[model samples]
Target: MSDALEKAEQAAREAATDTAAVQIALAALELAKAAQQQPAPQHHQCDHQHKPRRSAGEWIGIACAVCVGGAGIAFASLALAILGGTAAIVVLVLRSMWTDVQKRR
Candidate 1:
């Protein structure tokens, strides 16, 4: 009789703890949703590096390609080169997105 009562009491305690934790998680989600409805703060970072959207690596690559490849490729073939660059960029971006989706699982 005592063993049965002890097991029941332990299971009841666990159930209560689980319920409390779920309530806490729900409350946190509600708070997050409410916060999102409000406007963001204006006292944001004003740094020059943060303002420009593009990263330094991207800018450097673009500059180098323009300086080096721009001379060799002319106006007639520029469109073809741009098409090739666009295709390469698209492949890289899609590959990254696919990897990210896989990692989520």
Candidate 2:
């Protein structure tokens, strides 16, 4: 009877040791996976320089677009009004580019 009891006690100790080892191995695997999955840190640089100013023509273009949109809504043909406004904006952009080219020359 005593021999049987000693064998059982040894078996229990071995099982406990195996469980602890398995738990430790699982923890280490999880830690390794987490480290591998981490994203690299991002570095951002701040600019303190002054922003470029928009020319008066650009402001006028914006104002004309808003006014045209309002008139289109009032006339109950919003689509046509929006199309006209877009065309006007394109012309204004082209004119500004032409002026810039002239200035350079």
Candidate 3:
């Protein structure tokens, strides 16, 4: 009689384990369905507003700035030319001094 009871208890334990596995599989299926039903995330776009055209006064200001910039660039070129000429003159004078010293030697 004891042996029969032990067998029955073991069978009950196995059935319980099988029921838990079924419950877990059902829960997983439910999760998969919920995931598939979810809506895709939407991207929000900003409405681009065009900037107004520049006024006549702004145009005149831009032109003045361009003229001033051109004048500044011209003056910088003239300064660089003057510096190059001065450097050439100094080099020539030094070369002449060196030749004179060699002749005296």
CA lDDT, every model vs. true structure: 0.92, 0.94, 0.98
Q: What lDDT is reached at residue 88 by model 2? A: 100
lDDT of 3 by residue, 1-105 (tens): 999999999999999999999999999999999998999887986699779999999999999999999999999999999999999999999999999999999
**What value does the lDDT take at residue 69 in candidate 1?**
74
- The all-Cα superposition gives candidate 1 an RMSD in Å to the true structure of 30.9
TM per candidate:
0.38, 0.40, 0.53
- Using TM-score as the measure, the top candidate is 3
What TM value does model 2 have? 0.40
What candidate 2 gets wrong by more than 4 Å, as runs, is: 46-105
lDDT of 1 by residue, 16-92 (tens): 99999999999999999999999988886766665659999999999999977767667649888889999999999
Clashes of 1: 0
RMSD of each: 30.9, 19.5, 13.7
Candidates sorted on TM-score, descending = 3, 2, 1
lDDT of 1 at 71: 74
In model 3, the worst 10-residue window by lDDT is: 41-50
lDDT of 3 at 11: 97
Per-residue accuracy of model 2 over 1-105 as CA lDDT, tens digit each: 999999999999999999999999999999999998998787886778778899999999999999999987787876778899999999999999999999999
The CA root-mean-square deviation of candidate 3, after full C-alpha superposition on the true structure, stands at 13.7
Which ten residues in a row are the worst by lDDT in model 2? 42-51
